[model samples]
Target: MAGHRNIGSAQSQSFSKAERLNSKKLMDELFNKGSSFVLYPFRVYWMKHEQPVPSKVQVLISVPKKNFPLAVDRNRIKRLMREAYRKNKFLIIDSMNGNEKNLAVAFLFTGKNLSPQNLTPNPSLKQRGMATQKKSSVKNLPQYKLVEEKMIEALNQLSKNSLK
Candidate 1:
């Protein structure tokens, strides 16, 4: 958490446990074929299907290089996203605990570059026709605010739904 933003409150720190999923088979089983829950910019796809004691949550954060060519930018965004999730995912954990449900979550980055300055249909298009055009990379894409809001909303809804 060095050089990370500490914006959330203490109540958002309940999810402190970190469990590792070492086996590729396990990861595939959980993430590859699992029920998905979509919030918005963040998609939570998980299931109650795992071996051994189901007391832990395995998570993965993704930042598509196709969307963000710069590895530095992608890594930075992923770090921020993970930090945000680590700070906020406690709500979902508590709700899941209360509901007695085991889960596996993956935080995927589906953000696209839609800046007004670079409003082209293709961000990776190098040539338009015969002349050869310059392909402008993704510039000034939308921030992850909506992703955070949608995560909160998803957690809140998960809490509500757990009551039933």
Candidate 2:
């Protein structure tokens, strides 16, 4: 190799730091004062406030134990929610426009056990070419799509609210 230099240490990426909200007052304001939009799986609440310095976004993740009785199931859902947010949050960031305002976002898992009545066996159909067409075994997740769409809608609403 003519030139192979290690640049792992030299390279740095700017990542957004999550400012978690743990105060009762903040939580109350978030629920009371903020406007919320439900995208099935996630309900996003946001409000803009003045700050001496630029405020970073705060986030909270929650899973209802009643819905998911097992700790493992709750944890798994939480992990997936976090990953989805992490991957798609950049869209929200881009919408912020460098405002010196704080943001609070929460992802609540609303998934419950599928009803037995809703369960149907996958039936295989023969294709014209060769392989048989197999029905997808994956459960439909409308909430996930709702989350993404509602995020965009919320961002738009937030921007409009900021203008007023």
Scored by lDDT, the top model is: 1
Residue range 12-122, candidate 1, lDDT tens digits? 453344543455766688677776666655566555643664355556677877778768667767876766666677666666654445566666777664446433333
Across 27-79, the per-residue lDDT of candidate 2 in tens digits comes to 67777897766654556676665533233555567878766565755665566
Cα deviation of 123, candidate 2, in Å: 19
What's the lDDT for residue 4 in model 1?
A: 70
Clashing residue pairs in all predictions, respectively, total: 0, 0
Off by over 4 Å in 1: 1-17, 20-22, 53-55, 99-101, 114-138, 141-144, 157-164
Which residue runs does candidate 2 get wrong by more than 4 Å? Answer: 1-17, 51-55, 113-164
lDDT on C-alpha atoms for all candidate structures: 0.59, 0.53
